[model samples]
Structures are given as structure tokens and as C-alpha cells.
Target: MKMHLWSEFIAVIKKEVVPALGCTEPISVALAAAIAAQKLSGKVQKIAVCVSPNLMKNGMGVGVPGTGMVGLPIAAAVGAIAGDPTAGLEVLKRITPKDVIQAKALLNCDSVSVNVADVSYTLYAKVTVSSGIDFITVTIADSHTQVLSIEENGVSTYIAPQFCSKKPQSYDPFKDIVVKDLYDFAVNIPISYISFIEQAQTLNEALSIEGLTENYGLQVGMTFQRNIERGLLSHGLLTDVIMHTSAAADARMDGAMKTAMSNSGSGNQGITATVPVVVAAAYLGVGKDKTLRALVFSHLVAIYIKSQQHKLSALCGASTAAMGAAAAITFLLGGNYQQISHSLSSMIADIAGIICDGAKPSCALKVSSAAGAAVKAALLALDGMHASGDDGIVTNDVDQSIQNLCALVNGSMMQTDVQILDIMINK
Candidate 1:
């Protein structure tokens, strides 16, 4: 029996699965700046960016698109100079070299300052753009692009609600949902209703192709490709999935001038969840109908796991997202729901405690690593192997196991975020 409305399911996925340029943290900073710029009457002369520790941690070392710079300041400046506010996460998509030059000039003048916010929200970015006499502040919280409020000169201004409906609607899609619900939806939902998911392939695969072909940071994907050519690495679904998934991360983390279809506000998470299934289905010669169903299952499963955890934590989202791929790969491998449950449990057992130091070129390595484990875990699940109930965080119930993992991340690992950020800042 379907326990949730298909409308509810579509709304959740559409809201979360969207396109983002560059790393989401920096791009979010840019979006906030662009919003401020859009509301300003004069040229932007100063910018003040206050973000939560998690935001700073992720945005600090990652590349900003088209600038060859790595940090929030350049992203903010470029966003102010050239970003389009209505474009949401793609605010920096249209940035040009001329815009980069102007942003650098603004930075040289010491016109931009980024500080850690005093707030407690895990995903928060507040950008204040000024034209000397007047300024606008745009704040996004909880979600990457969700604008909590817009203010001009310390007074709240009216901005159309981006995600709100004319009628108040509760959007707790995961409140009572489980993996079984995801399976049912993926299997029973009409293909036309979920075909929009194919765009994840269209957007993410381009990033992989660019990352493999170009000398993006670390070249993790290209490295796998090279090894395969020389017989150093066996070329197959698993290796190819890892290569394709990591390549997208390499391009995204290196600020390759392309957009990624982000999942749960992280582009690498989207790539990890999408490319593995896409590459696997292609390698296995799966049909479009089955592949699309698997894609929906993969992405929704990723979203479901993420919903159980903090928006950002010491927990590497790549692992959680890869669990989704694990479930999908099991489905593609002709495993039943019980095998899928084993795959999820196996993934939790395999990567229950991966840390997210921050977003960087090495993130591709993590995505690559997790994608491989997901594939391996799925195969093992097919063979009736999984984490024992007595295992650290695994349990007889998959849902309970996921919550245990979240408990660890949202509980003790928060301090890990602080320690990691401390080391990063001090170093």
C-alpha cells in the first residue's frame, strides 16, 4: 500500500534535487550576494558575509567557479558584480572574466569581509552588500538556497517566497517514510512522473566527462582511466562507476566552469548517488525503464538518509549518498527487497563514520572510495552478507541502524567538525 501521495514525493525530490554551480557552499554565498546586489540601487562598494562554522569549513578551501580563486570572498564579490539573484544556486553561472577582474579589484580595496556567524544553524549564509550609503542583507538557512529573510538597511523587505505555496502546506516528506516506501514509489510510480530524474544524468555526466578529460584537481577520475588503459586497474562496472563518479567531483571541486545537479545541497553527494547507478546500468546494459526506476530509488534513498542526519556534519555526505547507490545497484543486480535491506545495512557497516573535513579536490577521492564500497557492499548483500545486528551502529532494523548512525554524527561528531575546522583555520 502506498502510504504517501505521489505529489508529496515529487515535491520533496524537486525541491532538493536541483542544479548548482561550483561547490554549493561557495555558490550559496554567491547567491546570497547576488540577492543583495539585485535589491541595491547603486554599485556594490562593500560586502559583509557572515556564515555558520559549517559553511566556512566547506567554503574556505574549495574553488570558486571561473575565478581560479578558492574561498567565499571571491564568490561573494563575483556574485555581487555579476550574479543574477533569480537564478538561485546558479547565481555565479554567468560570471565572466571581466567580473572576476572587478571582484579582485574590490578585494584589493579590502571591501569584502567574511566571518563566522554567531548563529547555531548548520547551513547558514548571510551576505550584506552595500553601495556605501545603502545596503541589503540576504540570509539563507537550513537549506543551501532557501532564503529565510531579506533585509535592506536593517529593515525587512518583501521578497516573493520561493518555496512557499499560496496555501500553507507541510513538507515533511520523510517524517514517516522508510526505504520500503521508496521501493514502492520507484516501482509503482509511472515513468513519466519520474523522468525528470534523467536530468541528473545529463548534468552530472557532463561534469564527469570534463573532469576525466581535463586536468581538474587531483584528477582522481582521470587517474582511474589511466590505470585502466595500462591494465593497472581492471575496467568494469565498479571501476568505471568509481571513475565516473570521482571525475565529476574532481571537476566540481576544482571549479570546472560547469554546473552539478546537487542532492541534499551538496553537488558531490549528487554525483556519488547518480553516476554510480548511471554507469552501472549502462555497463550492465540495463533498459531505460529499469534504469530510470533505479535512478529514482537511488536519489530518493540518498535524500532519505540525509534527512536523518544533520544538514552538514563531520559525516561525509558522500557515504550517505552512496548508500542510496548501494540500494539502487542491488536493485539493478536483481536483488529483492531483503537483499536491498542487507545492502543498506552493509553500507552503514562499511562507512558509518566517514568524516567530512571540508569540500576540496580530495572530496573526489572520498566519493570514489564510497562508490566502490557501495558496489562491493551490494554484491555482498546479494550473497546474503551484511552487517550483524550486534555491529556498532547496525541493527536488525535498517531504519534503526540509520538513526544510530545519525545519532553518532549529530551527537559526538559535531565536536569533530569543530576540531577539523580548528585545524583548518590554524593551519
Candidate 2:
């Protein structure tokens, strides 16, 4: 029964935790536009896009997959011109050079303007399109790709928030994975089932090395790796794992064409969680079976931690990923379930409130530092040195500890979210 439950859990996680084509914010914009455009059912002559400051700020600096452009205008334009809503987060995957040209034309016509919405929601985007004879407006809010309302001409063809009663839900592949179930899947799943984990290794390791050669993100991972050359840090599994994990963030944020397997809609989270374990496996010369288990632990733990926080929180998603990385590293270092919980607890206490400013090349450094801290936390746990409940936010029970983290991000951090966005906009 336990094995069956775990298998089912892993299935759900694998389905939810997959690759996303672009940065989630602009993709949400394009997705809303595509739906509205499809509803128009005619030639799209004009398109207008309105977005919240948070969405605009994030979408402003990140790359739209397969297109070299950044920001909401192009993403909105492409959505109106060529995007398919059915593609989900990868909505703009089919964009072509012709589509890019057409999108630019739409922008040149002064059709896209980003403005703050009166609503105080963390996630929001509204797209309105006008064809020759028809006009449609679509609104996405509170969650990425949540189309709250839709109208065509004067008719409300789709009334979502009222008639439709579901909150905007993200693609959560790890929704059902419990810690024990993940452990079982790691220990018993066929090696073939997790061969994809190796790709995380290849892609991320390349990025870490590239980061050292060039300026990538905070250069935290590369800087640490370089310490080995200077004899400041020892050459070992920890160094190797951090290097590989951070390198991928460097590449992805710096606009590398290589694809990364994303988790809960962010590629950096996927890299931070998976690459470190993969590097550890390589450095320690671990067998495929053990390696697969460690990778699953890392990935599933990251997914679980992400579930605790609202997808968009005052905190950066990396903090959650770092917790996941820390747990995975604990397992790699021969820590059992108890120690895994300890590492997670330590991570929760330490990095729970790190805010997400935006996705950028500099994110690599943050990822590296987080991964390094995760390693330390895990090592400490393996030695039976865990954060005491009396100190900080650490709790006696692991699940309750995570809930405490969720409270901080979801319940207590609203002001912090607004303030961060305000500062970014002012800067």
C-alpha cells in the first residue's frame, strides 16, 4: 500500500513538474491574449495589453523563450499575433520571426501600455484585442494563467470568477508527493524512469563553468568553485554540486539557448534542486540507483517546499528551492528521513523570507549561495545539530515548521511584497 501510494504520488509530480517555455509572467500575458484572440475568431487587427506593476516588473527583464526579446509588449504582441492558449505556460512556443515582426508592428502602433491596476493582487494581467468587427477582453489575475473574465464585444461570453468558482491553479506536478512516498520512489523506481535527471547535470554543469569564465548572476557558485583553485575551498562533492547547480542559473538568466527542465514554472528552481544532486552523484561515484533516489528526493522536496508558499510570495522562489536542495544534499550525504527534516527545518528558519525581486542573470549567485547554505544545513543535520524550536522559527514537527514558513510568505509578507515591487519600480 505504501509503495502504491508513493508511485501514484511520483506520477502526479512528474506530470506537474515539467519544462516551461518562458518566464511565467509574460507567458501569462500571452496566454490571456491568445485566449481572447481565439474568442475573437477573426483577423486580429489591434491588441492592447494592461498589466500590474509586479507582473510588468518581472516580465520586463526576463527572456521570452525562443525569442530574444524581453518585457510585456512583445509577449503581448506575439500572443495576439501567433500564441496558442492551449499550450499552457509554453503559450508563446510557436512564435516565429514573422510573428516577431508582426508583434513589433503591433507595438509600433501604440497598442500596448502597462499600467497599475487598482486591485492589490500579486499577480495580474489584462489583454484586450480588436479585430475588424469584433473586440474581446481577457483578464488574468492572482495566479499565472488564471483568466478571471472574458468578454467579446458587448457580450460576456465567459464569466469566470463568478460562474467559474475555481481559484487560479498552477501546474503542480508535486502536489501529491509525500516525503516517504518520494523516498520509496527514489529507492525503487527503475533507473530508466529517472534518466532525464542526468540532463539536469549536463546543462547545469556547463552553465556553472561558463559563469566562472564570464560574469553570471552574482557569480556566487563560480566564485566558490574558483576558491578550490586558490586552495580556499577543498575540491569535493559539495563544491562540484554547487558549481553545477549555480552554473545553470547563470546560463539561463544570461540568455543561454539551452533548455532547462523547470519545476512549478521556474527553470532556476529545477536547476537548483536537481543539478546539485547530480553533481554529488558524479563526484561521489554513486551508482545509478542511489543517484536516482537522491535526485528524486531533491526534486520532490523542492516541489513540496514550493507548495508551502503561494507561487508568488514576498520571498524569492529560490529560498524554497534551496530548502529542497538542502534536503537532497542531506540524503546524498547519507542522512535519513530524520536528518532530511532537520535540514529542511534549518532552511526554513534561515532563508524563509528572501524576497524575489525579479528573474535576472544575477539570480545565479543567489542560487549558489542558497545551495551552499543548504549543503551546510544538511551536513549539520547529519551530525545531529538541528535548529532548536526555542530559537527562531524552527519547530518540533517538520510539517508544522513548513506551515510556519507558509504563514510568513502567505499571511504576513503582503507588505513586504508591495514594498519590494515599489522599490524596484523606483529604482
lDDT of each: 0.91, 0.74
Q: Could you estimate the TM-score for every candidate?
A: 0.96, 0.83
Per-residue lDDT of 194-298 in model 1, one digit per residue for the tens? 999999999999999999899999999999999999999998878998999999999999999998998998899999989999999998899999999998899
Candidate 2 weakest ten by summed lDDT: 170-179
Clashing pairs in 1: none
Question: Whole-model lDDT, candidate 1?
Answer: 0.91
Give Cα distance to truth, residue 240, candidate 1, Å.
0.7
- Give me the displacement of residue 102 in model 1, in angstroms: 0.8
Model 1 ranges with Cα > 4 A deviation: 159-171
